[model samples]
Target: MKTIKILLSFALTATLFTSCYTEVVVDDFAYVDEPTISLNQLLRSHELWYVDINSTLGYGETPFLQKAFTVSFINGVVYANNNIAGLGANGDGFGIDVGEYNAYENILDVYHDIDGFSTFDVYEIDYNTIELYNPNNDTSYFLDGYQRNNFDYDFVFYDNIHYFLQEYEAWEKTYTSEYGAINEFDNENYLQFLAGGNDSTFRSSQDDTGINANNLYWDYTGVYGVGDVYGDAYLKTLTLDYDYLGNEYFELSVINDGKIELFHPSSETVYEFEGRGYIQYLKSESGTKKEKVQSDKLRKQRKDKVANPRENTRKV
Candidate 1:
């Protein structure tokens, strides 16, 4: 009887072990049906849409649109400011403002205008999902200089400038300078002074030591975004370091008005500011629109002069 009981116990343990070791098989061929309404269809059904930029930045007061032109699905064309029909020929081009990095729950709102009827909705789309649409519709024109190579099928379109403007304003706030030094000098003069200075006191403090007692060093870091509208200008973390007492300090300084908070990593003290005077000064000193136009015309003339010989040779 004891031997029979031992055999039964071993059988039970073996059964438990086999049950524990059972494998779970997932069917890799399982398929899901595509949604009945394509992103384009949804846009055609809605009239007006706006993306919430505030949703991207953890805390902001506005939203931006993915495209800032009136989209005509029937004609398959996009217009900038509703002026000059052709793409790149006479139009301002499509404006897209992607929001900040921290807002994980943010979405792009697309609006559609149908037969004098307008409706809007927000869709959650990301970088990877936007790669499916064909922007190369024969009748469509992308105003922005950068050509779109990848298309995503799931993107919704919106034709609202007001919505885009609101978001642009918010984004502009991020690039403005927030700090400035009271005493600043021109780059050339400052460099010459530093290089030719005979002051033993200044030299003693800053010469070989990493720690300079007479120099006030300021270091700042900021975050930015990236997209086509602001070609090559994507969101980035920027750092600016300057030695206030050095003449070369002004040349190395950077200014922006965007909401910024400065912290002393050693002491953990934070300083926040809304604007910088240095940037304002530089903007004022830059040439006016008329001067810029003249400069551009001259540059084109020079290029044409250089290319004329090549064209003549080709004709021959």
Candidate 2:
């Protein structure tokens, strides 16, 4: 009787283990129907996948996808546009290689250089839209695929203008419209939009700092926000809340890569600021042989130009 009981217990344990293993294998590759195109071909079919950050639905973060505005999969490598300065021109529109990825059955396994391994279940929602669901984090990021020529780089830049403001150490006042009533903003000569720490912090200085970003002194620190103007792709609204000066509002527009124009509705004044101490993030060494060589040369040029910090700064 005891021998029979032992045998039964062992059988039950084995059955449970087999059941769990089978469930895992099935879950990993849930779509049983044979795909018309392999996952590799599907990912590489488009030149870029624009991560719609606002549409993300989950609590957890997925490494590179969370930070990148767009992700590209090509030749088993992963590239991302982590900055807005050179979105359309960087790496011939491929941006920087952040890691390598492998796609099999409907699963994409990425090994990011800094964030390490992550697994995502890919689902095609439509012809241009696809959902990248990270099972580990219970997060889903919807990406709209586009070719290099079709992608609207301007829209992406205006949509994410907040990050662009933080890209420079300081914005020096270069132009202010002759018209409009004089207000407190006229006294503000420089503005600094910072990242981290709540992500909306801004500082203003009345001193003339020129292209020397580090020399600027903060006279007032405040919180600022950028809001979109409905129906207009290029127009945005900015508001700066100061502790002593109350709230200031303006119509913001990107004049160029390093210049921003803010139209103050209250005073009817237009202010243009030039970015100082421009920051460019991440340039990896992985890509095609030619791309790698080009990146190397660019790195050498940057090294030589590092002696003059103002080389990247521009006057409006």
Candidate 3:
């Protein structure tokens, strides 16, 4: 009787642990749409440009920049361009990649040359439109409706000299993830860039979500390009370094005015952030300039260290 009771208890404990673990997966997106057979011919003539992305599984919000990804079908080869200017050109940034793609009835196969992997089951909506979505799966991902781009727009890349965070910019996590991201702690986080420094505050924090009102800083110079989200979208990438949070590469979209966006970009992992607030932008001169007071203070510190060997230390 004792042995049976112990066995049952062990089995129940094992089941509880098994149910709690969430498996991590890659944010690999494939397109799925349904249209007529003539859609194949339509794809060969024009390019499919990434326009917008909506999170049905996460926040259900649309990204700010809509004209980033470009895909053109030529002969049997699929040409890819990202953050390329002038309606997806032929040289440099445009058509930098050559891959293969095929269609069999409603299903399309895309072979990415960079990844060296061919993805299956992504559908296209006829020939002129492509919606990368999976509505039937329990956990789904999508990129919506790549349109034909003809207008002349210059591509932009992220650079620190031109695109670093402004001192007064206050941005909350506007992007709540899909795939059921766990807060696991109390759920509020906010950050502000201030006067050559970064400050963060967390309200009602959680234990394991890595939420703390600790030190915050930039990891490296940011990057902005006609980068790929589903196919190839454009956004500014900022990798954040924090005392408690470790590192996070935030996908940012700069809309008009102070409006912007943040994306976590992992299919299996989730970050909880939502709601309204404006992002403050710094002028070109103000962002890059340093204050006289700060410079003088730093000089004094170095002077103090050199002035007093016993108070500080002299190595070598």
TM-score of each: 0.19, 0.74, 0.31
Residue 6, candidate 3: C-alpha displacement in angstroms: 86
| Shift of residue 140 alpha carbon in model 1, Å | 9.1
Q: Residue 165 CA error for candidate 1 (Å)?
A: 16
Q: Per-residue lDDT for 1-316 in model 1, tens only?
A: 9999999999999998776665322222232333445555543342222222112211111111222232322123222222111222222233211111111122212222211212222232432122111111111111111122221111211121112111111111122133443222111110000101121111111122233223423222122111122222222222222334422211111122233333323333334323211111001122221111111110000011111111111111
Per-residue CA lDDT of model 3 for 61-95, tens digit only, reads 11111112445555656554332212234333244
Q: Order of all candidates by lDDT, from best down to worst?
A: 2, 3, 1
Q: How many steric clashes between backbone atoms does each model show? A: 29, 0, 13
Who wins the TM-score comparison?
Answer: 2
RMSD of 2: 13.9
lDDT value, candidate 3, whole model: 0.36
lDDT of each: 0.23, 0.79, 0.36
Comparing 1 and 2 on TM-score, the stronger one: 2
Error of 1 at 153 (Å): 22
Candidate 3 local Cα displacement, residue 141, angstroms? 7.1
